[model samples]
Target: MRLIFTLLLATSLSVTGNARIFYLAPGGSDNNAGTIASPWYSLNRAWSVVSAGDTIYLRGGTYAYTQQTFGYMVGKNGTSANRITIKNYPGETPVLSKGTGYTNNNEHWRGGCYLDGDYITIKGLHFAGYTQADNFVWSGLFINSSNNVIVELCQFYNNGGGLILEGASTNNLFLNCDAYNNRDPNTGYGNADGISMKFISAGSTNTVRGCRAWENSDDGFDFFDNNGYVLVENCWAWRNGFIPYTTSQGGNGEGFKLGSTNSFPSTVLRKLTNCIAFKNRQSGIHQQESQCLTQLYNNTVWDNGWDGVNFHYLNLPHTFINNLSFDNDIAQVQVSGNSTNTTNSAGTGTNDGGWTVNVTAADFITLDTTGISGARGADGSLPVINFLRLASGSDLVDAGTNVGIGFNGTAPDKGAFEAGGAAPPPANQPPVANAGTDRTITLPTNTVTLNGSGSD
Candidate 1:
């Protein structure tokens, strides 16, 4: 009887042919009907009926009332112009999971929905309540043996192993998805990593952008055991425990953790830009392993429990330019263990722990031309740092070395701010409060200029 039903569904789908649209609702029909009123009940029914260039739209509701398994293989050489699209209707949230109150020993009872295809797009769906410690029971959306796919604008909350992209899945993009509050009922160790892209094979060129991961028990985002080019931009991670655990041996909970040693001979290059890390329990940002280039620019790291930028391991070269670190208890840049070949400089800072250089009038125009703005000391006033300024009676009007790093523009400036600084003024103009007066402390070599920015 089941075989006959499958054949009938396949035959109906083949008959309808190109560009068909089907709907899935609770306990609906599966006789190849495409209307929401007379929709198909299960994804399997829709899959059996959907052909190339077809779309399967799921209604906004809970599905799989019973413990049922639905495995759909996407990709199948679907073209970018005529690809298969599985999406939820606009302004609706659909959930796919194993039936409620059904717990299995292998953890496979939590909505084992697997995708094993390529060139497919799944968007705007919410997957939850799934639990899987090992690889058996997976998350709401498990993608294996797929490529050239995109999952965007979806929410994965309160599920086990939130979202897993494994099994040689390459060239996939996860955009603006949320994974949080997922817990493992069995071992009590689960991760709400907005997403975990595990490539057993070589998976390259993946992008994760505009995502928010907060308050998750595990790292907000983690990538391991793969040789891929990943770019994480404009993402925010706060209050997440053990954030970005790259590896067990040399992994520190950080706002952005990149590169790992889980798989030897697997080189990965990650680029992180325009991000902020503050008040995290661990380091604001961590980079380990060998030959991993962490280019951090135009970022703000302040008030972290540990060092603002922590680099460990060996041969991990970091290019840090034009970043601000203020009031961190530890050194702004902490290089420990056997790590080598690191370059650190001040692009900007209010209360930083480093060599204090004065910027003077002569050096100001020169340094400003080079893009290094004069230092606004603790007193909210500009100091001087130029070579000739020091030769004259000027305190720091000219007492800086011309051998420092240059800015993005022509010439070089002294202190944190270049000619055109990265930190912008706060929106919505408001009145400034004065803290009274400024006190200057004279040091042996260079005088310490105290500003309203407080202690570092």
Candidate 2:
């Protein structure tokens, strides 16, 4: 369904008379009036004369891109109040495809669905299969637009990377998007990622809220080399830096990697709250650059290969409040290089350098969240999962030092979940069950049988 969003962004966009609504469908003709009954044949035709305050609705269909001449939803500006919206029609999907033989030159050659516009809204779209090749060139969606753009309810999978919003991209909002299965075939310089919004312009910031990134070849969310502050809230990342789709070896993986590995550190601050990072190949959350200030609040992380949440290289102090870490291979907090860890809790003993609470996994209702994605509420907010919810009467509840945020009980909880925070109102969802019983399964046609691993 189309969302009723307010346009309160601050920017300069030309006043182009009044708003217009254009329509595009698979079977539309260029000669049509761009109306619902007679939509335009291509996005190029609809956006050719589109102005500020105009809205373009893409009808449900598979819009495939060609390498010979790629398609771009490019250079259509909209104002703050009356923004331009290019979105899928209500209750429909617009699947954008990078057709067979997707090459590496889309980043340089510009041969795919490219997004380069300001103050535009893109929603309820899926992109597929823009992979292979190296040099970190092409991606499913290339975004280098100006300001106040909103990318929502979009899915990018099996691509080189999901989206790259860089190069002076500012004040962009990414909400409820999922990026997975992005891989680089070139092992020499593998950097296939999910959605990276680094290198943002000075005095411009980007915010990612209610996003899910998982199972990409590289890091799930990369905000490296950014000069502006990046705020992330209520997001999740898991199984990154490995091919979750094909179960293959992925590139340099980290769940949420803040700052850059380059010589120069990021020149801005980063804030994260109510996020979860689990099951990633590398550290669940890591900051490469020591100079950048980081603020972490009410985050939950577990079962990662390295440290659940690490900031060992920090010489400058940071804010770490009410974050939780458990079941990671490395120590709860790595104490190195003038570190000052805060009152965060790790299941293991938290006595390294500045650790405080030694909260254990038993304090949580459940330790796993294999089925926690997209189960929040009708609006797709943070899920109230049995996985990692703080147990009643546990020391973690109300044991956290106050961070000026609201509390459900007497005080704030140590982790993301609060004891008395109400769950989402009831909704109509199909029942689901997961189990891992030892059994043999045989394909009916192939007559191939395999044994179960007896795990869930």
Candidate 3:
């Protein structure tokens, strides 16, 4: 009997020592234990209680706040082996909103949540209704000075800005997120971008992948004065620089503002891969005065207000390959300085050399943009759409110089969506499953548990 009691106690201690799970809900109380049945009331309570390797699951409901500066500031750090996770309860959406009665200041920045912690993962939460009366620079979530953070499967809308990463934030990832409908009324719809990563030092290596941004007042994705190596992959941006539900245009309006004018030249390093930009008010991809070498590969830009790609800042050693630029109001690609421009659409750079190809409406399967803003998949991936897919018999198929990235057929196609390669597959495919390793059990432990968590 004593041996059994000791074993049970040891098991309990081991479980608690390794990791813990907490719960948060709209109607919970700080005084109560943070169990699934009796959760905490606020994110602040969770921040005060959680530790490394802990997870806090927020329940479905609107968590309204009236804070003037920030609703919640998460400052706890986690280790590389075990990250602190804040996620919504499965199958439910938890929304964080800035309620009425919050003071608005144009000079100050307001945020619904501020993440200043390292090695954290925040997923499947919605940040909405965080706007000010004036043209205050606000964000649904602000990541400041954080490292090794992953913010995935989140939504940010109707805020002053969607998400902003700044101030020494390094090695962060924003994956499969959406930002839309963010406008600043007082600034004549200026200063509200879908996502902006600015003011970080070089070598930060922040990345954004599989994300979508649309209908923001300012640029879709802005890397303004960020002296870091930033990457944007498999992303889409459209209809930015216009007010939501209206034709009125505002702000700089570039779909992907790679970099703005920098006081210190050649400070930014950026790479774009498999991205699509369309219908923005300004240039599709604009690099203004960023004299650093940038890489543009397998990107598609069409029907933008200004040039498809305006890399006019005299940056040396830029690389433009396997890109498609079509139907912009200005030139297809307005570039200067030195670049390795090859395997792209005709007339892309000063010394363009590639297989000749012309893009027209007949070259694409569809250009309707109907399902661009549709619902995401169940696993929080972007919806697969037919927009901008190369037609079956287009000359662009297998016509690109391989830049070592993965490709199908003899060579990669010259656009964001590869002809029969990386183009999104049809919906409703069966999810693949995986069972964990096999284990042997003795007579005392005849029953053994298997881990299936790694299955998709």
In model 3, the runs with Cα more than 4 Å from the true position are 1-16, 68-70, 103-108, 261-268, 346-357, 421-456
Q: Which ten residues in a row have the lowest lDDT in candidate 3?
A: 1-10
lDDT for each residue of candidate 1 in 1-456, tens digit (9 for 90 to 100)? 011111112323322335778888755756747587788767767776566678888888877535444434433445666677888975576787667654444323334566777778888777766655353435667777677888876777666656667666678888767666554434334344446665535446677665655444454566655456667765555444532222211123355555453433224366665455555545566664423455554444555556666654554444554444444556566543332222223223331224232322333223122211232233222233331111223232222233344443443332233344444343433334333365433222232332332221
Candidate 2 C-alpha lDDT tens digits along 1-456? 222322322224343335678988867777999999998866667778887888888889876654423346676888787788888898788777765564434345423367677888988777777665445545677777568889888888877777778887888999988888777765432577788886765567789998888878889899877767789988888888876665566776788988763332334368898888888888888887735667888898888887887776756566677888877887666544444455677777433545565677779887766576554455556555677788887888888778777788877888877776676457655433323345443222233333222211
Task: Give the top-scoring candidate (TM-score).
Answer: 3
Q: Could you give the candidate ranking by TM-score, starting with the highest?
A: 3, 2, 1
Model 2: pairs clashing at backbone N, Cα or C within 3 Å: none
Per-candidate TM-scores read 0.63, 0.83, 0.87
After superposition on all C-alphas, the RMSD of every candidate to the true structure, in Å, is 20.0, 13.9, 6.1
lDDT of each: 0.53, 0.73, 0.80
Runs in model 1 deviating more than 4 A are 1-17, 27-34, 71-77, 101-112, 131-138, 188-192, 242-253, 261-268, 278-281, 288-291, 302-307, 325-332, 335-456
What local lDDT does model 2 show for residue 271? Answer: 86
Q: Candidate 3 lDDT, tens digit per residue, 64-107?
A: 76654434655689888778999999879999887767644322
